[model samples]
Target: MRKTFTRTILSISFLALMLTASNGYAQQNNTNDEGAQHLVKWNVAALLLKNYSFQYEQAIGRKTSLALGLRFMPKSSMPFSSVLKNAIDDDQTWNSIKDFKTGNFSITPEFRYYFGESVFQGFYVAPFLRYARYNADLPFHYEYQQNATTTVKDKMDFNGGVDTFTGGVMIGAQWSLGKSISLDLWIAGPNYGFASGNISGKKTLNSMEQDELRKALDEDFKDLPLVKTKYTVDGNGAKIDFDGPWAGLRSGLSIGYRF
Candidate 1:
């Protein structure tokens, strides 16, 4: 009787081990069939602004994911015309605005919450952070006494840029075209940040010339509501330091492929 009981117990143990192994194998196979869960996207609106932007997204859970983007604006694509047009007033000084140039690069990281059933599709809310570095030549005007009686006026080139850090919340929608393609649209969003840089003129100025330039800037930019200005006199020339609140609008459209 004892020998018969031992044989039955061994058979049951062997059957249970086989069933567990089969279930584990089936789970592994299912995951392999699902494939990679990531997408790569290009921003079309960025190209229109003469910038190249690329984004990558990966799924972390059923309703949450993370996205990272990189944007580049080469020196050749300097002088973003649209931005300059909006920032500058078309007054007498408008004609003085020349030699406008900018070189910038930025990185953005966003955390998203999807409302729809899929990870990268449907309406979503994302809070994003961006860091950027830039170099630019802004426009300025100055005047000096040509002689004992006559005064002459000319434009001065302000050469410098800023490093900026900002964060904001974005709400947008995305749709899938087929199994492999998707479109992303940014509706509207607000961003706020700070910038710090030096603005130095192309040529060195004497004490009298620096005073004249300061007076000119005060009058010309008094009505402009964007930046708070400070001036520092250096050995080469006077440097205008800008430290203030920055705000702007954000929107874009992108197409992506899933892999």
Candidate 2:
């Protein structure tokens, strides 16, 4: 975990430095006598565009440009589920199920390779890469109790962890609405998926040890009665798979400056 976190931070910082260095060069070139002839631009607002368009002008420019910005999604969600339902309910016979909710935050670094000055951004497609994380906590608690019934009562409480990986292709156009503002609007996805969850519970049970009571409860516990058991349960695991389009959106506006 520590290594992963460290590497992610380092990658984001390195991308940021490159963006800054490129901005310095673009600004220097913009001051030349033939301003319109220069192909460089440095504007923070244009950097913030959430979408990109694939047009001849924006595509004709340089193919290699580094974009460093934070992908802000007031919300990043992942599907979550757990197998430890028995830990939460006191009566396993009459089980109740609960769904888990997930969320996370990540720093997104983008590199764009324009195809050249052509209708389809010089190329038929632009491939992009993104690294994201999904971290969340799910809590469950329940208690069952009975007296004189030889009936059993159980209660459990737990929490778990979830992680994810997002990767996909974005189809877009670059609309140069003047030099300061540009719009890149198109849908992106085929988002990849990876996640895991954990749950732990502190359990306590009390009930009659009578044979009659035990028999009534069920055959699963017929052998033991007038029983009292206390246990600690914990689980941690992970998973990986491919997801459909829009399965998870890391989409957001990125405000960038040219120089």
Candidate 3:
């Protein structure tokens, strides 16, 4: 009976020691994992374009992570003088056009799967979804006749905006520089989506003038690769309703830092 009690006590003590050791090992692993998990990065390429973009990533498992990005570009305009000089040269017909203005904000979320050993480094594939809103204004010239003998020319502005939702897959490689800095290169990816928007012209004209201007625009834009377009006469000018497939190129060299 005494031998049986001693054996029981030894078994209980051994089991307690084994449980304690296992818990300690688990706590150490948890500490190591917490150190490896959180990362925040800013896209330097977006900054170079005068836009603010930031990315945050958190590891959910050994080979998977969730990333979120935000980008915003305040109202900005680019002059067309340089492009016109190269495209039209000394053609006076296109010289009156001024500049193009654009602005946008977007949010993108991606689920990333890293094939390498580390979380945010090496080759990865991500399926991402993006939501964006943008505004733009493009200026062009049109001709009208003020009287039977006088022909007048005026500059008109096409102003519009659109909201877009897109989903695509991205394959990219990320390399680390020392411990905290990294570089990301997106190879090539295809994204397809849809956008619906309204484009309005900025001109005050009579009904006959509006009809003539709409007709002129119809003739001018007939060759454009738009999916669908509808024109409506507004108070002074005209508004265009556009519904189309939106395609854009997505590739950039971004410098980042890991935290």
Off by over 4 Å in 3: 1-34, 79-84, 90-97, 144-149
Model 2 C-alpha lDDT versus the unseen true structure: 0.36
lDDT of 2 at 208: 30
Ranking the candidates on TM-score from highest down gives 3, 1, 2
* TM-score winner, 1 or 3: 3
lDDT of each: 0.73, 0.36, 0.71
Q: Please give, for residues 102-165, the per-residue lDDT of candidate 1 as tens digits.
A: 7789898999898865577567899998888787777665566868999877667778877778
Say which prediction, candidate 1 or candidate 2, comes out ahead on lDDT. 1
- Candidate maximizing TM-score: 3
Candidate 2 C-alpha lDDT tens digits along 1-259: 9999999989856854554454345445543122232123222332233222112222224444443333322222221223344444543433323433444444434445654342212222344455555443333322324566544433233344334445555543333333343334333435544433333333332333233222333443233322222222223211112222223543332221121
Worst 10 residues of 2 by lDDT: 237-246
Candidate number of the best lDDT: 1
Off by over 4 Å in 1: 1-36, 76-92, 144-149, 222-226
Name the 10 consecutive residues with the lowest summed lDDT in model 3: 25-34
Of the candidates numbered 1 and 2, which has the greater TM-score value?
1
